[model samples]
Target chain A: MSVLLVLLIVFGIGIVGFFIGRQRASARETGEVKVHSRAYYHGWWVFLVSVLPAVLFIVLWSAGSSIYLERSAQASLPAQTAESAVASRGLALSMVRGIATGLDRLDAQELQNLPQSYADLRSLLGSKGVALASEGQDYMVPIAERWHSQAATARTIGAGLAIALAVAGVIFGLSGIHPRARARNNVERIVLWGLLAASTIAILTTVGIIFSMLFQTINFFSVVSPWNFFFGTVWDPRFADAGSGGSQGQFGLIPLLAGTLYIAFVAMLFAVPVGLFAAIYMAEYATPKVRATVKPLLEILAGIPTIVYGFFALVTVGPFLRDLSAAISGGGGFIMAQSVLTAGLVMGIMLIPFVSSLSDDIITAVPRAMRDGSLGLGATRSETIKRVILPAALPGIVGALLLTASRAIGETMIVVLAAGVAARLTVNPFEAMTTITVKIVNQLTGDLEFNSPQTLVAFALGITLFFLTLAMNIFALYIVRKYREQYE
Target chain B: MNLMTERSLEKAVGDKMNAVASTNKMKGDKVSVFYGAKQALFDVDLDIPEKMVTALIGPSGCGKSTFLRSLNRMNDTIEGCRVTGQITLDGEDIYDPKIDVVELRARVGMVFQKPNPFPKSIYENVAYGPRIHGLAKSRHELDEIVESSLRRASLFEEVKDRLHDAGTGLSGGQQQRLCIARAIAVSPEVILMDEPCSALDPIATAKVEELIDELRQNYTIVIVTHSMQQAARVSQKTAMFHLGNLVEVGETEMMFTTPKEKRTQDYITGRFG
Candidate 1:
């Protein structure tokens, strides 16, 4: 429902309640019988009181209720269907778990045991009803079966409570905007706090992400010293004991960090000049009609999802780059599908709009008077723009470039797909590389052992990425503020 | 005549007459102006003499400033403003396509009502025109031009030591003098002052008036002022414009003491400015 419509309804109710309350009090205050407040204030106060709780409840319910409903609907299936479904689902779960544990991969019989074991479990669970009826048992079942039944019951109840709680939230939210509401003032306060909170959220989230990584990194450092992670040349993060049964890992992070920076730098080199020039043309040279058509078209580039860009990089840019590198290098050892250049070019395409839109705004904000003043001195239009307007807007443009740099550094998907998983610290754009984010995804996707060096290294990489972006943002903001002060 | 009809008639006539008159040995003539659909100057006729200060004194909305702007073609920059009548400098049509506006503006310089010295050092402000127009070939020549211009404006004594300070950092009177110095640096034949001392105090006004007398020996000056006393004190020729028409034009002493038109007399006597 529209927020305005909701407020109007609440206001109507509040007005009616206010008159009723005022009428009750008026007889006591004034013998001749008058309303307690100016009719509007009374109406406003009543609306203010009821609407807040109603709105809060509605918002909470909207966000949280649907998940509970899906579970509840699952739980309330018919008894026969439930028994059959649970048996089949249990069979499926065991199969998944068996594959996950690598148990089924051991031998032919072990793999073949997957189907047999599932059938046995299914028959065992499904036969419980017959056994209970035939044995004439009222409530005495085996402890294991009883425990399972209790668990199922508890799941159902939990699902119902979640649904009800969500519904209750909706009711409370709607009630907030009702006639006796104090919500106008409450909402105003919330909006003010919300704006402050939103600004804080960016900083807080950065800190939270960094800390999450730091804690895990600390765990990694406990096993391998910090010095090895920071400076060791080799990054063989798979150190398996020869006599032992499982995975091996080594924890050198320098190669990965170098690869990340190299790829990011290459991407910026591709993006910055093209984006800045495009921004200058759009802001200063283009007519309004052309700008209106082109600006949104540029923004559309930004609107495309990163995942889509990643796919494009993989399917299109990768092969094209590989062929081009082969042609350029005369087929020596320059395979280019998993190269820094491929990732940089794709990432540059992703960043073009980010840089252009920001710099365009900064350039456009340059005052018209500066241009006029120069032109008045008989300077040509281009000369005026070059000497006066560009110089004045330079600091702001630098800030915009810094923001784009931060975005480029933090980007993950394009780098992941086009820039392959070979993490070699090479300056050559034709060489394959990996970034911190791609490594983090690889480390955490499987049945991750939290304390293992491989898993813990992901966290350390995340911390480094977070700090770099945070520093970029803070410095960019400082430069932009200082530039504004100069003009003002 | 009423203001509206006078403007409407001027708009109908156009700027060709002013152009022809200018080329035929008149300094400035027949200038008509329009701001969008509303006309401000009629096909007005006037001759501002060489090497003498000409005072244009009239009631508000009498097209005095409009006519003043036409002398230098400053009205060309105002959006939706159209000038139909011609104006000339030294028997050359200023509005002619062949005339370069930049060169014309340098030849016929103007100082506005407000003291608009650029936000720069006083020396730089004075040097702006000379540097841009390539009037001074070297640093020594530029320095000489700047010193002479400031001396001519009578601002050299007060600001000689602080030539590097921002012009805007000076007091209002000093800034006005600085602007005058800046205008004179280009060494134009005609100098247009639009209520130059209206923003200055009495002492500054007297100083500027004295400087105007001194400037008359070398340049033709046209001053637009509201003050009758200042007009009487500074000008040799006075042109009284009323309702966009030139009511009377003659020697300043003769026009003031014995105006031929009743409107001119009424205005000069301070009945209705």
Candidate 2:
């Protein structure tokens, strides 16, 4: 049975069961709140009973049947084709499955009158707007026929078992409805488990991703020594396939690490003061009309896609800096068009909203009482803000800065477009440099195979980047939470 | 019944405590207050005499706090709060356009209902006002001011050891005293307290009441309080207000013992507001 059809069937069963159980509870109810549980609880209890088991069965059946059908189809392929089919069983099974679905689209009369040859069958299916793989041979047609029959059998068995369970569940739900059954408590327990399962899925997926990256990183480390990856000053990933006069593979992370930090530092230096002063002005001095208009306008910078910011830096800021540098030098531009300065400047602009919004909230949260106390002491408004409000808001602002630093460090698109990918270990902001994220993209994009040191190194860089941001987030949260506790 | 209350109020005012009263240090001549378009105080006139504790006692929202805040121009901080008529200190109009509000506040400090200590060390809290107003010539002079303020607020002995401790970490009563010290450090001519004991326990209230008594020797004070007994205990003079009306004013003992206004009598005897 189709998954959507199974869901519809379960919903229909739940509705039927709800009415039956609701009727039973109402028939026996003495007055409102007199029963052990509410009539709605009794109805929900029946709905859960009728839908849950059948849904579980449908999920398990679908999973089990797909694996079983593929294995059986691969087993039944002729010995001559079996050797090749074993190597590409996944692809072949998908093709076989497609043909099986196409057979279903043809009713009994059309299917009986179908051509024996695969090309004729393909043409016939094409006229019906169902295309098969052109490589499907005459011998494979019989296998496709078998696949269709087995799929029908599996659907029948699955639907039969699901309907049987749903019926049994309805009967059991009806029998369980009594005055003292505590249906609400049962429902509550089931709901708790449902929520638990949902949260567990989120946590488990993160763990799963981390573990997968960990194994790949372990593999990459086997080829590249951890010492060289961490402490070496140069970066050059070259192999036989690396066209255009490439150097032999020498993976050094320090240049990328330095570039990342230098860019992030420059971005933060630009962002923090500008953002904080804007926050203070907005929070303390701006009129309500101005604040309401200005805050969203400032935040519109945040909503613009970083990719757009990337090219904006590429086309505009990069060229502007290059020309300005050339004009100052009086001969030629030493500053490259794509340099750390261009990326850092634009990334800082992107992060202004982040810092301002968070710092504004923290500054605004400093109690009115604190301001009042300072003002009542004969301190001017500016004096009060400087002495009391900023001091109180400092910890949360530091947290916001740290979080923004991590965002700058991890950002890929802006770096990729505006900061050229040379991976040079230069401190001068005018020179070209690349970050870990851009190189991670560089190593992994296009038709690269995953097993090589060149490709697997991306995973290693990925885990390193993850840990960097993770450490930043943890430290930021600690400072932020400490600030909150002080206020309380 | 309400007519009789107002009639008695007028008769009592005609026969009230103008005889042998202390000279008024700060006086309001028909001071009326408005917040936006709504009237909060209706042509209310009152006197705060020098070196005396005068308490404004009234039911909530009866404009006594508004009247107290108006004395020091504390209402100036509030948006849309407007005050009319003359409020004078030493016979000079403090609300004159030439009169700086900041200097006025320096001369007349305020303590709020809730204990609002700055998020700083206790020592710094007391020194803040003095330092801001440039009252101290040196660090030693600042230290002496802080010590004297804390001593006068009666918080010195308890907090002498941990003067570096955050003001917020102090107990509720201690925090209130710290605020009082903060107010006192500026050595203002008048201190306007808006229900300083409202958030305190009975013991804290007693400690603060004692502080107020001792403070009356130096600064003139106007206190707005809801407790009638508190008014009876700490005040030398008492004023009664109802529905933004100043119903009566007299010496504290006379007002409690023989209030001529029916509204004052009814309020003191636990009648409805």
Candidate 3:
């Protein structure tokens, strides 16, 4: 919040300075003008001179004062508290953390005990002076008392300097903004820079996130070889020492990867045709009456929460599929409670509107004359639609499908709740399976181990998932470009 | 005159002199057009002819295009555009329960003001009709049909070699010719041209006018035009529509030279439309 305030103040100062400087400059430019430059330029010059130096001073002083305050506070500590070097350093660090986070809550008893502990430690370490100070202690008492007061004084002075800089900036800024002011242009430049800064911050944040993941994944890769992590057959995240333990644990990603692909493939199989057909029906075949009624009904599917889909998969589709599978196979357990089929089916339903809406927009964008050209030639309506409309809208539809795939790949909560914990490498949709996201949750939810392969593997999987989606996005973009070129 | 042209002229002028008089000249008796409950054409009554290219000319917002569309029931495709009209193609009521719209459109083909060509080869553009209608049995038969249609449209000599290229790559006039060829490939009895030369240059307009004269030999043509000169050049019979009413209908030369109605004379003499 203070950072924002500082920027706002600086901007105001710059604007004010511009106007004052412009007025001065304006007067100078014209023979009738008393000053050497435009009035607004003169105002800007004065504003820059007045505010910039003070802002710079405040920034330097505040940064320097923090370190100075901390060091002074430490140095002001009595010989009793410093006798034990490690203890004193730990206390100092804790004190700083407390100030920063507001987390340190020392009760009256604790505070009392701290001074006594320091005194005892001082005596034990053969330190001489016996000094204990309270917040109420006067400045004339001793070095410790004076130190505390000075620290408080420094904070107050730093705050006052900040306020003074801000006030000076505001006054100069207002004084500069007159009738002949160039303050608006100065404001515009500041706004442009502010936008640049904001975008840079967003980019820097993304880079920071990526590097943070990369470092942890590098740690994970050191513990588990990259080849084994990428291509091993089994997926057992648990690691047991073979020398001490009765049985060794397995760790392989093939099952998870296979499960994810199978689930997503099933989802796409259900989603693409249904969604695209819906889009086609809406865009081409349906009358206005039917379209008006049906379009919103279909779009309403997009608004339903994915969590609701998860519940539906768990409670409704799971049982339905189980019964259907049993009827077909003459057995009940062929359809597990948390089977890929249930999750895939529900996810497909959830994704229908996303695909349909996007594809509908693209399909509708196709010129009506394309259909007319075919229809005018005595082609049946269906024939025209199949040959002309579908072919023209194919690229956009494919792009929508790829985007749906990316959504399915990154889907976390639905799969976590509905997809089973078991990871199996199989094509049978009835079988239970896990995905990368589910495994990441399982590994990282509890007490985190920075060095453990189990925990670090989550970051590795995250990076892999990121790349997968990145590839999908690029492919979608390529298709969109290709489709645009066809029309253009 | 050819066998078809002579028969059509005799049937149009002789059989329908005062066919139904004031009410029956245009046999669109039960016409009712709806654009989502906003009726654009209301029970329209008019007479269309056999051999002549009847020009349906009117000011803007007069439902001229709507009435023109109802001739072949083209309004059927527009959503919520319900029509209840007894439109006939050569005395056979087109809006009958049994008449197929697909066949009706093929029988009464249309050309829009804008030259809309398919993003396909010029050959494909001409061949699309015969291929769908199965007018030709072999590639050779199809090729001959395409050539004749293009020739009839007066575009064969210019575009014969480049028929393999996209139809849309042609110039505006050439594209319109390509569209005409496409329309002619099906060999419809009546060709409806909705201001065909509106998007063409003067030279292209002359070429299209010359083609229209040649095509008048076989096909009964209905044209909608904003230009009176275009109507005078191409049309044999003229129908003047205003505010969704048939203001006048007469032979083109008589209508231009000596109109009976004051509005018609005023319109011809460059007065307010």
Local accuracy of candidate 3 as per-residue lDDT tens digits, A56-169: 766787678667756765565555554544355546444433332221133335334433233342342233232222211221123332344455466566656665775676
Error of model 3, residue A309, in angstroms: 1.8
| Candidates arranged by TM-score, highest first | 2, 3, 1
Error of 2 at A431 (Å): 2.4
**What DockQ, between 0 and 1, does each candidate earn?**
0.13, 0.52, 0.37
Model 1 error, position B118 (Å)? 7.1
Worst 10 residues of 2 chain A by lDDT: A239-248
Query: Taking the tens digit of each residue's C-alpha lDDT, what string does model 3 give over B29-145?
Result: 657678987877766676666555677776766677888777777777776788776776667788888998899888888787788777678998899888888999999999999
Predicted candidate 1 versus true structure: per-residue lDDT over A153-184, tens digit per residue: 44444444443443443344443333434444
Highest TM-score against the true fold, candidate: 2
Docking level of model 3: acceptable
lDDT leader: 2
Against the native chain B, each candidate's TM-score is 0.90, 0.92, 0.87
- Cand 1, B chain, TM: 0.90
Candidate 1 yields a Cα-based lDDT of 0.69
Error of 1 at A385 (Å): 1.6
Q: Which stretches of candidate 2 lie over 4 Å from their true place?
A: A19-41, A74-106, A109-144, A167-188, A239-248, A329-331, B1-21
Worst 10 residues of 1 chain B by lDDT: B15-24
